[model samples]
Target: MKNILLIIIGTIMLLSCQRDDTEQIRIKTKELISTHFMGNGVQWSAYPHGDTENGEWGKLMTSEKWEMNFKRLDYMKPKLFRVLDQANWRYMVGFDSDGEPILDFHTPEVKAVEKILSYAQKNNITVLFGEWGTPYKMHDLDAGNSDKFKGANDPKWIRSIVAYLDYLIVKKGYTCIKYYNLVNEPNGDWASTKGDFEEWAEGVRMLTAALREKGLDKYISVAGPDAVTRYDNPNSTYSGAGWVRETAKQLDEMVGIYEVHDYTEYDLVRSGGFKKYHGDIAQLMAHTNKQIIFGELGFSRNGVENQERASRDLYACEDSQFDVFKFSYGVDMADAVIQSMNAGYSGAAAWALDDAMHTCGDLGNKNELKRWGMWNSLGTELCQNPADENMRPWFYSWSLLCRYFPSGCSVVKTDSTGIEGLRLTAGVYNDDITVAIVNNSGVDNTISLNIPTHKQLKKFLYFDGDRAVDVNRFPIPVEEKIDAKHSIELTMPASSFVILTSLDY
Candidate 1:
């Protein structure tokens, strides 16, 4: 009798230990919050989806290749495609010797712009048309200093730009352009001309009135003063340029969205910038009726060795170095998404979609300014496969957030204890709920999901060190069903991202 009792006790102790190894995560299903929509931004005028056709090794943009690339956009089903017309406005529109604007439909750049808009229209994506500048000679705008800037407040210059917008909507049949931004980054080099906030506001008001007078106001709206720096600090270009506060006061009714760009390091986000940045966003929102948005969010990896290489170049890089870069980049992308959603942003779009041609200047310039493209085109000689456009680890990283949460999802407050850097954003859409976990703590942790409403596990997606480089290379996560008590446990790998979708009751 004593021996039988001893055996029973031993078996019970072993089972309890096994169950205790798994971690527990408790979730509050009723506590919900707002989440911003996730979208994409692309500079398609310069980059052919897959058909650059340079004829060196793997550079060929065929119709099939274009379709394959668009399928990437389809995978995420992004809400917007902010199309940038590369500055060289002379090639897009012409000026008579008398200075009257003439629409040029024969330019390849114009045709490229048309093709991009057509794709966006077909895919149900919103289009935001933006230009860097017109011919400097036509506007007589100096490129060097703000004091010499005279283009924005100039009536003739404003009319010329408004006329081009008319050509796009009224003549060439690109009625899909719902938003127009007069300048790219008025506070930075991409600025069309140097001008203070009031001067730029005058240009914006002129353009707004012109659109309304032309009967296009019902179809299109203006979103502007797209500055790259924050508004809080006067030392920053945006604050110094005076667009942040001045636009709110002068052109509040003319502008519909407060747009800005962010390329700050992740370390700053941890140190205190997260709160400061979001606090500034709140201040802007309070000051205006319009919503706030991050038009561009990406870090440049320019000086990093092998930063421009394709996946084929993986062999040339040290395993440790490449792994760290991939992991860190993925984490940063995930963190950006979480931060934007937490701040209640209207919509957040990434910098770009692809590296146009291997030698396209946009590729090099974007690499220098913001290396945040989803696909990097390997130079003609180095592409190993016929379909090798060199999708970066970020491709899958961004997809993890966009695909799982979608645009119309509502975020809920999910408290995660025990780990320092593990952040979560839970989005609920209709009958589905998705919880995305970004683990940057460098230690494997267990996530205990306690949801009383969800009982069915819909799907699981992840990207990490073992499967960072290639989208097709990932292991299946261990399946877990909601326990009889209404809970589930997941093992989250260190320096990785995971998404869990469940059926909402």
Candidate 2:
């Protein structure tokens, strides 16, 4: 998920006041929406080095009482989840050992997987085992035997793991768990660990082919989270040929998707941090022939008034050019899905379930780490519990885009607002057309809009501002009118995101 410069925005009124128009919905005063973004997921934090492994969470997961996390499975597993995209199951276990078997999947202590998997299936969330990560060498292997490229890095081990994953999808009656992440963070500091991008890409390529032979040809594959790179920086290691770019080239014939992590700004977004990692990846994937995913992302709420310094808050996305970067979850979801889909991405996930704290922890800010959860942060400065839970400000922003564009929707072009401070993107879902308008100004401003597709427009959601309103609760009031060709116009707000969805007439 790359965030390039802002798009162009001109004051050209979409419709003239003199135009005769008649539509079902009429224009009204500025409509406000608070809560919108809604979703939950389980990244591999509970696993060994990570958090959610075999039921246990955090330090508890790696300790003797690992099953403790599973005990709470029935109560929390499927509470309200859909995209159960297990990011590091295979990687956390590694390629040296026999994957799941080595991870003790057979152990009665780890039997909760059946319940978790069953719940995900019943709830309709597509189950995606994020591509596994390999180790730099045999020594890097976790004592648990999950790291790749170590002493036990036998090709036979690869075959077994692919076969095992295939068995889960086929024998288990699952059609949705069809994608595979080839490598996780295959770029960056691999050299020090005796691993490099070329080797990693080749290894992932072998695994991809192996999986195909194991009868898993339909599994879509992803590469990267090529750490942070500067599209503008020449010495920047990110722009250099990395695993994501290399692997996509080798697997050119395979039906697959190119992916990467978009946390380039880290936890500085709340301080108004900005970057073009999302757009740069989109451009990079262009040659590889694949869609993109931000992989993982989180905005800072630890700044002034919990909004932080502009230098730190990359969550609101100050980058003007792109509009598809969604936070955390890896399910290819969000408003940018429509736009990113047009760019090459089919969808994206929000990067996490209850691991908000983990994401914050990585930022190295203990205080901010607690505020990362979708529910509430541990700091109590942002979110605390269900009572104050209304989806973070970031969630609403995603709803402004994802609420309208589901799978199968084609992205449409916008009229182009050539302005640096504003960003506008449009997409079509079924017969409906949706426009996402964002004004990245610190202060509020007013602007006119032009929607050529529909005769009437209704505001779907607005992310940002002082409201915690959810998208489902309120529908933007549509003015009753239509232009000659049935075009509709409306007023938009400042530092706000207004989503206009088409109604089936």
Candidate 3:
């Protein structure tokens, strides 16, 4: 009888300890980083090919296809519309050999610009008019003289650009234009020397003064240096953060916004030194008051993973397989955005909104060239014929950020442990809290977000090798409510993107 009672007591104690362990939960606290975000923006560069039938823009401007694209854009709710002033063929449409006043806006590109501006105005999106380079006339004495180009610092170039801006805003009545980027990637070829930066600054000052004289200054602000390469490289005199600092010191308030294009595939978060890069850039905030924006960002089409093989099974022309490589590309891009914002950037823009119908560059041309569009503008030659304007996996991947932490939401910091190969970004939409997790590891994960036990886990969406789908819509529930101990567990698939929200707003 004594032995029987001892055995029973031991078993009871074991059961009780097990119960206590189950009741214990992980607790996490998150705090806000910023009060507001400047909203998401996209470029309206040559979206549709210039060609008539298959091209996306000009010929199909009024067609059902174009309408569908805009409908999709409307869903994204883009805050800023960066417009390209230079079109495919020439510097501008109206330049003549006689050097007459060049205000003619009759070409397809000009018409496209007008249409885009009108659409943006209707949607209340700010327009950032950007010039890719000096006009052909300003650079070349004759139309075909590529070698006879004058440098960007020339006074004649400045005057001509200002004249063009005056024509676009004051003369043509594009009153909706809000921002102006003087030249895209000037450090690449246009302006290199510290003196050159000063010249560029002077040009901006003259241009703003001209616009103010025309009474359009109130409508348009200026952003500059549009450096294409890294702005923080120490070895190079004209590249990296050193270059940006020198340029900013020269420009001062001539330009209120400092911008750059990031085509960084080599330096990714996975490489382990990306945080230091952001930290270095953030250090620049101490010197200048200019708001920094990564205006254009994308990974190379011929990415480091692999690109030599041809994709056999998919739609359109044969190209690289849309599997892990594309998935990784999207994941890396998400990290760049997160890090950029975390480092105090105002906002970031994807390199492009849509991929082109045809391959662009000669040297880099392939059967299915990488034009860096969110959607693949596949031609009608492949298995899924007439896929001229179909969305790619990236469209879904990017929508994760667009859907959850929208513009005006405040960024927050979250603490966690035991989660590997995962990046979490949180934002507060008034009283509602949103947490986004991007999982790059090849294994599925069960995450326990430590928060208030009283709050209910409202909704969630996830994307893994697919478009973002609502978790609640699935047969199985993916999000669990916080238990009495204040722990909410979530199961995230490998290479997935998840967004979780609290029930109460």
Candidate 4:
């Protein structure tokens, strides 16, 4: 009996030691956050939905718009694809194209398509097909002249596009290529640009239904890409971006996500900025049950600096709160992650990968500006070149997020409105074995992550620049590595983004 007691004591001691070790390994690799949800331009119209554009003139970028980086193998990698051009749709119906069509996706452009596919496949990136065409041909529906369905897609065309999407998805092996935006800005009638709401809704519903019928509904999201309206200044180049939230209130079919464009421009104009954090975007996300994507946003890259927000309208969805530097049209990776995560979203795509700095401006020197490519247009520079990890501020911002968070991770929101520079998002990673704590704040915000106890942590990785720390600059600056637990506290910096690894199962 005495011997039995000794064995029991030994076993108990061993168990306690095991628990202690588990606690030790729960290392808190702090401030890991997603910089930019790696994204590039996509368009179904650019695709032809299986049909080919026989020689329609492409959207002719002025020589200025074609600002080449002048250093790459092809000046412009040209691996990007275009959706159906709104102009091309008009051509199909024998009507005038209000917008330029993205024609020229023929054999000559095969290389571009291949490059996009190859890059995406290798990097595990996501390329989404956004708004490029209406549901029906332009002349066929007379939407160009009608305010109701103006700038909206036509029903017939929308249905056909869905079928084509399946074929492309299956044929092209587009596994990483999902997340489609059915139309762009459907509040017609909201922006005063004009478009049918009920018709657009029908198109969204039909396409979603088609996906369900094809058993691909689970893989796609049928939604709108509407911009928020400005209640203060009703007339401006950015005036049409405004939309009615109720128009996008609900999609007819089950949705996987909801994408919102920056209602304001990339400029510092008080009227061109987005309403205060919670006014438009924040409130929109809260009201909707769909995944939100800031699919389009950018500054004019030419706005005057130093605007006074003291007298600006912070309510009515007016976007005059961000500082002028924030509105310079340059992509701020840290800010993007902070804003998106704080909004409790899956991810958000910026205006573009490269804002090819236009060398020439007016006089049709459109290249000097207007060209929003993040890199030199048509240049070999990375879409967003992060020399130190290619973690251009935007790219680095998304790094911490994607590396650790699952594709389906939901925003486990905390109760703070404008954490200012701080953005926090919590979710399960690696099949729930690891709990991801993303801090996109510029300052060190304390993240008290709540996870199941006894889950030993392995190591932590922080991404703040363009590339991973091992591969680039600006890694997580962890003052200390704590173990895994619900109350794990770690300092997250405004410039820092990080990830934590644990075996909490």
List model 2 lDDT by residue over 1-505, tens digit each: 1232222122123243222232212221122111111222334232222334433232323333233233322222222222322222332333333443333344333233344455556644444454334433322323244343342134644555575576567776555564555444444443221335445455556777787677677653433433333222233333443534544555555535444444333222212233233454567557754445544443322334334332354322222111122222211123233233334444455444332334321332323333333332222322333342333344444434434544444555444343333445555544565666654545454444555453455664354333334243323333543341443444444445566666432
Give me the candidate number with maximum lDDT: 1
lDDT of 4 by residue, 1-505 (tens): 9999999999999999865543322322233332222322322122221112432223322233222221221211222222223433323233235532222222433432444454555545555664444523323333453433333345444544555556546666666556665555544333322354455555667677677788776566654544433322333222323233543455524455555555344322222123244234545545554445555544333234323331232210112222321212222443444445544444545444433212121111221222233332323221232331122343333333334443543334343323344343455443343333434333555544544446555434344333234332433424454565455655655444445554221
Which portions of model 1 miss their true places by more than 4 Å?
Answer: 1-32, 35-45, 48-65, 87-93, 137-150, 170-176, 230-242, 270-276, 287-289, 300-325, 357-372, 381-388, 416-418, 459-485, 503-505
TM-score of each: 0.76, 0.62, 0.75, 0.54
lDDT of 2 at 104: 30
Candidate 4 displacement at residue 493 in angstroms = 5.6
Higher-TM-score candidate among 1 and 4? Answer: 1
Every candidate's lDDT: 0.58, 0.40, 0.56, 0.40
User: Candidate 2, which ten residues in sequence have the lowest lDDT sum?
Assistant: 28-37
Give candidate 1's whole-model lDDT.
0.58
RMSD of 4: 12.1
TM-score of 3: 0.75
* Model 1 pairs whose backbones collide: 24-448, 25-448, 47-356, 50-61, 51-61
Lowest-lDDT window of 10 residues in candidate 1?
A: 315-324
Residue 436 local lDDT, model 3: 63
Q: Put down candidate 1 lDDT per residue, 57-91, tens digits, no spaces.
A: 22345465566567776665666667765333324
